[model samples]
Every structure is written in C-alpha cells, then in structure tokens.
Target chain A: MTDWLDHLLILPILLPLAVAAVLIPINERDRTLKGAIGFASTLVVFILSMILMRLAAAGTGSLPGSGVYQLGNWPAPFGIVLVLDRLSALMLCLTSGLALAAQAYSMARWHTAGHHFHSLFQLLVAGLNGAFLTGDLFNLFVFFEMMLAASYGLLLHGSGPLRVKAGLHYIAVNLAASALFLIGVSLIYGAAGTLNMADLATKLAALEPRSRTLVEMGSAILGVAFLVKAGMWPLSFWLPTAYAAATPPVAGVFAVLTKVGIYVIIRLHLLVFGTAAGASSGFGQEWLVTGGMLTIAFGGIGVLASQAMGRLAGYSVLVSSGTLLAAVGLGHDGMLAGALFYLVSSTLTIGAFFLLIELVERGRDAGADVLAVTMEAYGDFDEDEEEEEVGAAIPGTMAVLGLCFCLCALLLAGLPPLSGFIAKFALISGLFDMPAAELATAMSAADWTYVTLLILSGLAAMIAMNRIGIRTFWASIEGTIPRVVVIEITPVVVLLGACIFLSLQAGPAMRYMQATADDLLAPLTHSERVLSAPRAGSQ
Target chain B: MELILSAGIGTLTASGVYLLLRPRTYQVIIGLSLLSFAVNLFIFGMGRLRVNAPPILDPGGVGDLARYTDPVPQALVLTAIVIGFAMTALFLVVLLASRGFTGTDHVDGREQRGD
Candidate 1:
C-alpha cells in the first residue's frame, strides 16, 4: 500500500476533529463563513469515506479481512488502534452522506438558531466517525462518551421548554447508561484480562467455564446499555420525545446515532461471541430477538398513535433499529446481509423525513404550547412571516414537498419499488432458508411472529404516513404555500434520491451487503489479523 | 482488602439505585453521580488494587506483567471520570433549565393534576 492510503484509516476520525476545533475560534455571528467551512469539510469527509470504502472492499494488506491502523505506532493489544473493514467503512460512508445532507439543510437557517451549532455538528460527526473506527473496547467507551456528549449539546441547541425537558431526560438516561457501560466494560476486562476487541475474542475463546458465566453476565449488562441506545422497547420511552424535540437537522444527524448502537451490537455479538466463543457462542440471541420484535411492535403502535410529523419520524427510527437488531439476533448470515441493506436504506429515508417535518409543518398554524415553543426556537417570528410572503418564492415548493412526503412514506412503509421493500423481502426470505439444525425443516413459532410483526409494522407505517401525508398536502389546498429555501429542499431531494438509487442498484448493493455480513460473522479472520500483526510499539 | 472494597462499592450502588428511582430531578441527578462513583471504584478494583505499584516499569524489564498494577483499567477509569463529570455538568444545566420552564423539578416535566 502507498503511504497516504495507509493513513486513510485515521483521517476519518482526525479530519472532523480538526475542522471542529478550527470552527471553535471563529466568531459566532459569521454564519456564512462557518457554513462554507463546515460544508467543505463534510464534503471532504464524504469523498474520503467513499475512497476508503473501496479500499476496504479490496483487501489493503496481507490480512484478507481488515487493515489495522495502529495509532502512535503502538500495535495490537498494547495501545490505541483503529480498524477499517467493510462494516466500519460502510458506516463511515453512510454517516458522511447523512452529515452532508444535514449540514446543507442547516446552512439555510437552522445553524443560526443557537450558539455553537456548527461546532457542535462537526464534533458530533467526529465522535460518530471515531466510534465506528475504534478497535479497542476502552476506546469504544471513550468514543461513545464523545458521541453522547455531542448529541446532548445538539439535542438542546435550539433551547425551548420542550427541548429542555426532553434534553434533560435524554442526558439523565444516557448518563445512567454510561455508568452501566463502565461497569460492564470493567467486568468484562476483569474477567477476560484484555480490552482490545480482537484480544478479548481470543481470550473468551479459551476462557474457563467457571468464568464463562461471569463473562456472559458482563456481556449481558453491556448489551443492556447498547439496547437502550438502540431504542429497544421498554427502554426507549425517552427516544421519541428527544428525537421529536430536536431541530430538523439535528434529528437528521441523530437518525444514525441509534444505528451506532445497532452497529456495535452487530460487530461485537458476531466477533466476540460467534462460533469462536465455545459454549458461550450465540449468547443473548434470545433476548435480542424477542426484545427486538417487541420494540418493533411498540414502534408500530407509536407510529399509529402519533398525531404529529416529528413523532412519527422518531418512531420510524425505533422501527429501523428494531428490525436490524432482531435480524442480527436470528444469527442467519444471509438474513444479516439483508439487514445491512435495510439499515442503510431506512436511516437515509427517516433522516429525510425528519428534515421534511419542519418544512411540512411550516404552512400550518403552530399547534400547541410545545410547538409554538419550537417555532420560536427555530427563530422565525410568525408575525413577520405572516406579512411577507415573498412573491419570488418557489411556487413549486408544495408540489415538491408533496412528492418527497410520498416517497418517504413509501420507503418507511416498505412499499414496492423502493429499497425498503427489497430489504424486508431479503430478510424475511432469508429467515426460512437457514441451514438444517434441530427441527430445521419447519419454521419456528418465533420466526412466524417475526414475519407477522414485520408485515404489520410496515402496514402501520403505511397507514400512519398516509394519514400525515394527507393532513399535510391534501388538507393544505386552502392554506398558504410554505416558503422553503432552495438549499433546504435540495437536501430532502438528494437524500430521498439516494434511496431511489439504492432501489435501482439493489443487485450490486445486496451483493456487497452480503459480503459484509460474511466478513462480520467469521471471527477468526479478525482475531488472526489483529494478533498476528508485527508489534508497532517497542518491540 | 477485596472484601472491604467490594462492600463499599455495593453500598454506594445501593444508595445510587435508590436515588435514581426517585421522582425529583435533583435526587436522580445525584443518584446518577453516586452510581458513577460506584462504577469508577469498581473499575479501579478491577486493576487488582496494588498498594504501591504504579505501571512504570524498570528499563531492563519487558513483559513482566506481575510487577505493576494494570495501567489499562486505570486509564479507562480516568476517561470515565472525565466523561462522567461533563455529563453531570450538562445535566445540572438542563435541570435548572427544565425547572425554570416547567415550574416543577419532576423528572417528567409535568405535574399530576389530581395527585
């Protein structure tokens, strides 16, 4: 490998951190300046992620699976490390794509609402990229803290009563979750005697049966922390409230945050406890599958029950997380590949939907105290907007909004001709095709429940989205046309446009996703590559 | 020594859980803080609680795992402490903000009209 390409792994985490720091000293009033710099930086992130994705797909080194980048020239189990494989690279590309759209949307006005908006946004991206790239368990905790801290700031960026209340709950819940994270990590470290993920995988492989129970308990506690972030049922009471309360762009970026939880679950569950785990293999699959199904059921109910646009988008996030979590739990490699595809498609769709909410709600009378607070938080005085309906504003906006709303509805509901349907088809079809095990000829009752809930949730999303779509578009014939900026509408189109592109290229995309699933399930490759590397430290 | 340390962590955790279950925001925040302290101690204890052995090794020795405390958990606990501190500050600000806005410090931000 060439020198620069060898350094590509660290750039994703470093570039965003550098840009965020540079943005900090710039004066807050320079919106145009900050927007330009942030956009350029995020665009670079997107391009770099794409390049890295291709590099990761075709092997970069002697290791057939991943290229481990040792930080500070310290290698293996000794020091901080970053790993770039198909999964993290795919996640990086997805994150930057979402960040690009959200940053563009923010430039129109949302970035000006509160203090340090651009800085917080960039830091959020940095944290996310770091979380995806880190190879060690302690580094994962540090990155998780970084991500959650940035999210807390971004969630309350606009600062209103609802945002404050929701942000308070959000911070409190996450703080407690962090405590659980520390406990779980410490327990696992104590039991396993290592913090590097690859090293832990090796250690757990040979762990005695007596301590196997202890390690299992640690992993289970750790799973609880991740599931809470994933918005699983019974632990997700705070998710919808917080997501709905966040500003449009913040909510857009946040669509990927819940997926971060799912990403960790997929990576760790398969790597640490896959077939290598000897007796502990397939640990917590039952809770994961059952809890994931219940979360989908709850999210479906929330989708049906929600009367507002933002809340619906929030529940849609829960639905996506639930689907992926349950698919991973099934432990079918084929279905997991399908879940990867679903993860990307659903995140893009819901992020676009979150951005679309503020635009759709723009034309209507501000609903209640909470919403009126949101309007003020968004920093537009209604009295001023009432007097000035600029004649030059795009008259095609309502039509565009209507089209985007319909597309989001189709995608979220997993209707045909969209990637959502293809993803779900792959997952459900792959479920029954699992290789022969005990009683393998017949579908289990759990499988049936998964299929039923999957279809029912899609139906619920379709109905709820139809209701909201009608309420926003058809019911607005007599209302004033909402004045949307070109910058704002472009992001919605580009995001939804990506979903359309996914549908068109589903053949190649599914192949790549399946490859990713294959890579994730086989732990020996990761452990071998990590441990066999020449130590970059004093050795 | 192990017994004393584990008992202390247990007591802190029990109190923390008790406070975390309460309705008031301040109490819950304190609960989270106390809970984090317990976790921090647990992490510290995970390193085997060496009395005098910091991780710095003699120049002649390499890979002598028994001579020093494990520096990894100590580092992990340090990172946790910093993050936990920031979280507490953020929660405190939000606590005041929510209290100012809702007129009640209830964690839910709403008062029960009948109760």
Candidate 2:
C-alpha cells in the first residue's frame, strides 16, 4: 500500500498523457466524448494529487522522503526520475484542481470552439505535471518545451487576429527564455559535473571558488529564465497582453503558469543552492525578495492601468508573484511556510477569477467584435447567433461576478478572514521577528523598501478594484438577461468554495506549509535517504 | 584561443543587442541566434578548457581524475543544443506565420505600434 502511493506521483502526469493519446485517434466530431474524457482525466489527476498530498504529510517513514520513480528501473543519476516531495505534491494538487475547474467551465461553453481544445488541455496538464515532478534538469527543459508547445496550440486554438498577435509575441519571448535556460544549464553542468539536482548539491560545495562563481552566474541566468516565466518585472510585459487575448478557460488555467517558474526557483534555492548564511553560499534570497518587491509594484500599477477584466486579473497574478517571491526571499522557515500557503490560496483565487472573466464575457456580445469575426470563418459561432447577448453585468452573472471580485480583492489586498490575509500575516510576522543584526540589518534599506512597496501595492490594488469593479458591475447598462450556463458557473463556484475552505481551515494549512518549509530548510534527512539507497554493485 | 573566444562572445553580445533594438523582426531573430551561440560557448568554457582529456570514468584514463575535463558540461551542452534548436525552429515558424497572418514582419507585429 505504501509503495503504491509512490506510484501515485506519476499518475497525475500519466493520466493526462494517456487520455490525450487515446483521444487523438478518435473523431474530432465527437465533442461530447472529448469533453467527457477531458473532464474525467482532470478529475482523476486532482484526486491523485490529494492522495499524494496526504502521503507527503504522513512523512518519509510512511513513504519515500522523495518518491523517485526510475523509468525502466534504471538506477538514479542515469535514467529519468520523477521526484515528488511536499513542494511538488502541493503544486500538483493546486494545478490539477485548477485545471479540473477550468475544463468543467469550458465544457458547454467552448466545446464547439474546436476539436483540438480537449487534446491541448490534456497535453498542457501533462506537461505541467511532468515539469513539477521531473528531477533531471534536462527533463525539466523538455517538460517546459512540451508545456509551451501545447500552450501555443491552445493559445491560438480559436485563431483570432488578436490571439494570434498576442500568441506570436508570447511564443517569441518564451523561446528566448528557453534558449537562455539551456545555456545556463549547460554552464552549470560544465562547472558542477552533474545534472541530477541531488548530485549537484553535493558536488557544488567542493568546487574551486572561480568554478563556483561561474556556476553561480549560470544559476542567475537560469533564474532570469524562470523570472520571465513568473512574470517578474521588466521581462513580464508580454504576460497581460497575451493572457488577456486568450479564451477565459485557457486564461484561467494559465494563471498557474507563472507559479511554475516560482516553484522551480524555490526548489533550486532549497535543494541545490544551499541556503546557508555565508558569503560562499549561492542562495540569492536577497535578490529574489528585491525582484519580488519590484514585481509586486509593477503588477499593481498594471492593474490600475488595465481597462478590461481579463487584463486586470492578469495583473493580479503579477502582484501575487511579488508576494510569493518576497516571502521566499525573506529566507526564514516561517516565511517560506507562509509563501507556500499563499501559493495554494492565490492559485485557487486566480483560477476562480479567470473563470468569472469567461462567464462575464459570455453574457456580453463583446466576443463578436473582438473574437467573433476571426472565429466566424471557422464556423463555431453561427449556431448561437440568434441568442441575445447581455451586457457586461447581467443580473444573475453579476452576482457571481461580484463574488469573484470579492475573492479577487481579498486575494490581492491580502485582507483578513481570508487565506490571502493569513498567508501574508504569517510572512510579515516572520520578517518582523528576525534578529535585528542579521542580514536584514545589512540590507535594511532594501528591506524597508520591500515592506513599503508591498503595503502600497496592496492599497493600489484596492483602489484599482474600486475603479474597475464599480464600472463593470454597478454602472447602468441596457441589455437582456443573459442565460447563466451551469458549466461556466460550476467551476467558478467550486474554486471559490476552495478559497473559502482554505481560509476557514487556516490552522491545518499553515501547519502543512510549515512542515514543508522545515523539510526544505533542513534537507539533510532527504539527502540521507538518497545516499542510503543501496549503491550499485555494492549490493 | 581564450582571447579569441572572449572576443567572439563580446561581438555576439554587441551584435545581438543591436539587432534586438532594431525594428525588423528578422534581424531580432538573427540577433537571438548569435546570442545563443555565444552563451553556449560561454557555458562550455566554464568547465575549464581541456583539449585532449575526456570525462569518461576509466582506470586507464590519462591524467588524474581531478585534472580530466568535466563531462557534466558536455551532457548539459548536448541537451542545451537540442532545446536551442527546438526554440529556434519554433521562433522561425512563428515569425513566418506572423508575416503570413499579419502581412508584416515588424518587431511589434503592427507597424503603427512601432511608433
């Protein structure tokens, strides 16, 4: 039974791949079958993720500390290993849950958009799960490309002028980032003499200072690649435009995209970089925190300037990016715990908002002028031509939209009685308690800058919320009552319920995040487990 | 050899930066390619230049193990080359598609946005 749970780690990744492969050969005309498969696969992934999370919480004694599945039974350091720790498990659960919701939302709404939607969605899930679980750096790059390729197809699934335009830039920027990632990995391998993350951690400390310096530089370059993916400052200009152009279901699922980058950074920081308090340590906690603060500030400003609801939601993601990175940068166990907790809550909240954006767009004829013409040629919108399009805030949809907005506000503002507030408070309190004479003192000016930036960003989000929310929801507009589709509403309600649950059950959530953080902070136990695995030929 | 490689890297960086600033999409693509080549070489060099020695583990291998060239970088470069090729191909396809769809190949996709 315990061994079976370790195999469960691979299921979240495999289920989607299996479904996608099976569905590809089937006729594209069978939209019902495709939707059924897509929904079922995503649900299974979510359930499997929950089981993995439970196993992770049970500790290494119950299961392997880091569940490593060797493909074809090849020994470690040679074949591909799918690793699942608490961090990966948490991310997998969040991603799968969000994906499940998004797929449900798309069923009745986007079914006829194209036959490729279901397949691409499954591939995206497979890639995301693979990226989260893979232990090999090269495999990580492979999964990243896979995810990007599927994303390209999905991003351009509807094939509109605006979507294509946005998709082109998005593809270009990500390709550039991919190139940089490869180069950085090559450099690290050159210096460290290994690609296995565990091996790198062990070998890096023994290298000459100059060699170490080269590796560190390589790591920073790689860091830039992840930061670009995370929608960090300066490199993130392409995000809002691209995300806003995507379909609501696609856009909502993509809210987790930047989180993948942050996840990679956090993993590498804890496992490979060696987060020791010394000059020799390559852990860039300070850099991450500073960059995070800048991202938060930039995201807040972007939200303020955004005219559309989708773009506003996109900016909200950027704000959360800053908060997550800052918490990680604080370099305390409590801060890391808080950041992880925030990660789960924000992912759910953002996913919900993305779904709402789709529902709101559905009520209006807004899709016609912007997305309809490009899509009309493809023959998906004619059947629904007779139906009257509602205004941006049809009464029934407005209520759900309002609830979504409140959730978004709670998340962005980090308000109390919500998961966002709890996560932020935990992180802020941890920062305040750090010894005064530590690195916090050396970087006091920068520290204070982040503190002020974070507080101000929250306030800015509130103000932006008022500016956008009031106009979209409260202002008078003339239109018929749009039919509120259950498929769309169900997903939003499900994700909203999740946010509420997390907020309500903050105690256990906080404890689990803390345990995960502790595991990262002191990885000696994890290292010992890997080393303890019987040596080849010795056995 | 080291000086020449350094000069090549510098030239690549400068040319890439210049092309990136250009309004034309093709030039930007060329710049990206040049930059990738420079970065690949830079990463390879970080393992310390060894002309004859291979990183294979053998009792009969020449020189002390410590003095041998690092194989890790080679493995990394191999993967990097593959990924880089995939990206370059993807970008080329996208650039061509953008040209076909938008009827322009400017950096910003739209000529007016360049202003």
Candidate 3:
C-alpha cells in the first residue's frame, strides 16, 4: 500500500491519458458510456490531486508520497521525474475541478456536435497535468506540444466558418511560438549542460558570463512564447478571437490554459534566475511587471470594446492572466499567495461565464446583439419604450441566468461579497504590508502603476459587464428567454458556489496559498529535494 | 563548417518570416514548416559540431568522454521534429478547411478591400 502511494504522482498524468486512449476506440454513438468514463476519470483525478495536495501541505520532510516519482526507478536529474509540491498539486486539483464542470456542461448537447469531443477533452486534461508536474525543461516542451495539439483540435471542434477562420490564425501563431520554444529550450540546454530543472539551478550559478548571456537570451525568447500564450498584449491579439470562436465548453477548459503559460513563467523564471543565480537574479523582472501592466490595460480596453459576450469572457481571461503576471513579477511572498488565490477564483469565474454565455445566447436572434449595439449607438428613441412593453415577466430560467451573470460580473470586477474581492484585497494588502522589516520599502512608481491599472481594469470590467448584462437580459428588443437545461446551469452554479466557498474559507485558503508562496520563493529547497531524492528500492 | 550551418539557419529563418507575413494561408503553412526546420537544425547544432563521434556511450568504456557528442540535443531534436511534423499536417488540414469554408485562400478567410 505504501509502495502504491509512492507512485501517486504519476496517476494524474497517466489516468486521463489512458482513459482518453480507451475512449478513442469506443464508438462515438456510445455517448453515455464515454461521458460516464470521462467524468469518473476526472473525478478520481480530482480526488487524487486533493490527496496529493494534503500531503504536500503537510511538508516535504519524511514524506515519501508527495516529493518526487522517478520513472523506471531512475535517479533524479537522469530520468524523467514528476515532482508534486503545493503549487503543482494545487494546479492539478484546479484543472480536474474545472474539467469536471466542463465535461458536465458539455454533455448537454455540445458533445453531439462533433466526434471525439470527450477523447480530446481528456487528452487536454492529461496534457495539462503533465505540463504542471514534469520537472524537466524538455519534458515541459513535450507536454506543452501535447496540450497544444489537443487544443488545436478542440478549438476547431464544432466546425463552423468562424471557427475555421480563427483556427487558421491560432494554429499559425502557435506554430511560430513552438519554433521559438524549441530554439529557447535547445539554447538553454547548450549553456546549462543539463535539462533537469533542479540540475540547471545548480549548474547555472557557475556558468561563464558569455554562456550566461546566451542562456538569458534563450530565456527571453522562451518568455515570448509563454507571454504569447499568457495573453500579454501585442502577442495576445490572437487569444480573444480564438477563444471567443471556440465552442463554449472548450473555451471553459481553455480558461485554465493561459495559466499554464503563467505557471511556466513563474516556475522557470524563479527556478532558473532566482536570487541565487549570481548576476541574473532579477533578470526579466522589469519586463514582466511592465508587460503585465500593459496587458491589463489592453484587456481592460478590449473588455470595454467587445460587443460579444464570448469575446468579453475571452478578454476577461486576459485580465485574469495579466493580474497574475504582475503579481508574479512583484516577487513578494504574500503577494504571490494572494495571486494564487486570485488565480483559482478568477479562472473558475471566467470558465463559468464562458459556459453561461452559450446557454444565454441560445434563444436570442443571431444579430440581436448587433442590433442592440446599433440602437444604443443611435441613441434612445421612442422605439425603446415599445421594446420595453415587450417584456412582461421574467421567467424562472432568465432569473437564474441573470443571477449567475450578476455573480460572475461581481467576481470578475472584484466587487465586494465574493472571493474576487477577497483575493484582490489580500493581494493589495500583501503588497503594502511586508512581513520582514528590511523588505518594507515604500511603494515604487511601478507598484502604484500596477495598483492603479488593477483598479481601473476592474472598473472597466464592471462597466462592460453592466452594459452587456442590460443589453442581454433586459433591454433587448427582440430577445427571447433562452431555455437552459438543468445540467447546463448546474455547472455554473457549482463553479460559482466554489468561489463562494473559497470566500467563506478565506482563512485556510490564504494560509495554504502563503505556504505555497513561501515554497516558491525558496527555490533552493525545492531543487535540493528534487536532486537528492533516492531511486526506488534504494531507499 | 560552423559558419555554413549558421548561414543556412539564418536564410531559412528569413525566408520563413517573409512567407509567414504573406496574405495567403498556404504560404503561411509553408512558412511555418520552414521555420520549424530551421529551429530543428538550430537545436541540433546546439550540441556542438563534431567530426566523427558516437552519440551513444560504449559499453566497453574504451572511448574518450570528450570525443562523445552530447546525446541530449539529438534526442531533443527528434522530439521537435515529430511534433513539428504533426503540427504541419494539422495546419495543412486546417488550411484546406479554411479555404473551403470561406471560398477564399486569404488568411483572414476573405480578401480585404485594400490588400
């Protein structure tokens, strides 16, 4: 039993992949069977991730379960290894949780739109888990490609003209990014002489200046690829369009996809270029802070400029990514903890929003939004009153959807009474209040810019959500109440309910997040554990 | 020899970038393929150019360590090639679908007025 537990780290990556392969050969007509197996697999992975998270939270000392699982009983820094600490475990649990909701939401008619939806979805989860858990730079690239391949299929699922168009651009841009990824990875390999992250951390400190410069240039290029995925402005023009055009359930899972980029950035940047890395300690820190603020500004403007609900949700994803990026660049332990909290809450909200948009837009005429926008642009007229007469009473479904929309809006805009507010509060306070006396410097110009942009972006989301909400729910001239299924709306409720739960349990969650932040800040301890883990049976 | 390899990578990259910015989808696909090829070579060259050396270690332990090439980049290049090939196939299919769906070969699915 203990031996089996020692191998628990591999299950999150392996289980979904096995299930996906099994699902691929099954008949697409066996929808019920496929759905059941997929959901069961995701649930089990979620539970496993939770167990792993608990183990990680307990501490790495004397724990055989949560540290490192070497493949084929090979030693670390030689064979591929999976390391489970607080951060990766948190990500695994979050991915599976979102997968459960997304898989459930897809069963309500979206699965029948195309073949292999369940298989691709499972593959996506497996790829995400692998990317999060792998401790090797090359392995990260492999998992990233796997994730991208699955995403390309999912984005092109439910083939429409719009989807095909967006799919072309998305594929092209990502291919270019992949090329860059290879260049960076190989460049780093050339300079560091080892691919294992822990091994590199030790080797990098002793590198000559010329090779270190080469490695930094490689990392900078690598950062571009990640930033493109994280939706940092300019590089992020493809994100909103591609995400908006995706089928809702796929888009819902995609809410966590951008976070993969942010994850790698935080992981590699801190692990490779941390305080112990001699002269390159703060390399790319300024770039991250500045680019993150710009992303927030761009996403805020995009949110306001967007006329479609799907695009609004997509831009919200950018806003979420930007906030996390800036928080990551700040390098404050408390701020990182708050950023992790914000990551969980905001991802869930944006995912629920994406799924809800499909159900809400179901009964409305295709061009009704365009008409509404044009009408608003032309100014209020007597026609508005006659349109108001068309509304008599709110149906039960519309009422529930409106309520969910309000919850999502409040969460996205960081309003009071939800986890979003708590996360932002924790984050801002964490920025201001330092735990150590020496680190308690006054807020710099950049910090103030970040705070100002953060608040302004939230305000922009509020205005956009309010405007779109009114147009969607109340002021529509020809809008009919969308008939939503119980299964469809339940996932949204569950996701929002999770946010409320997080808000209520803010104390424990923050503690866990702060612990994660501490672990992240202290990279040496992580490298030490990973590098020193014994081979199987040798211990 | 080093200069030649570098020049080859540079030319491929330049051509790929130029084609990538073209207005047509097929050109973009070809450009991506070229760019991936350039990257694969770059990754391979990162292991350092050696005249005649085995990438694998001899079980007899007779070979000098310095004469052996770094096997990691070779392995990495193989993975990169496989992924890049798969991606190119996918992009081709998507390109065809896009071409058929909108009845145009332009990257944006329709020809813009000015372009």
Runs in model 1 with CA error above 4 Å? Answer: A60-66, A368-395, A434-440, A535-539, B58-66, B113-115
Off by over 4 Å in 3: A382-392, A434-441
Query: Which of the two candidates, 1 or 2, achieves a greater TM-score against the reference?
Result: 1
Clashing pairs in 3: none
lDDT of 1 by residue, A1-539 (tens): 35665677778788878988999999998988988998898899889999888877776463222478887777788877788888998999999999999999999999988988888888888899999988888889888888888899999998999999889888888888888888888989888888889888878968898777878888888889998899999899999999999999999999999999999999999999899988899999999999999999999999988867788889999988888888888787769888999999999999999999898888677563244334435754544443444454545888899899999999999999999999899999788775567435567788888989999999999988886676556534236777899999999999999999999999989988888888888888887887666644333
Q: Encode model 2's per-residue lDDT on B83-104: one tens digit a residue.
A: 6777778678777777888788
> Residue-wise lDDT of candidate 3 within A378-450, one digit each (tens)?
9866454565455388889989999999999999999999999999998898888855664436678888888
The TM-scores, chain A only, for the candidates as listed are: 0.93, 0.90, 0.97
How accurate locally is residue A375 in candidate 3, as Cα lDDT from 0 to 100? 67
lDDT of each: 0.86, 0.77, 0.89
Docking class of 1: high
Q: Once superposed on the true structure, which residue ranges of model 2 sit more than 4 Å away at CA?
A: A1-6, A64-66, A72-75, A276-278, A363-395, A434-443, A534-539, B1-17, B37-78, B112-115
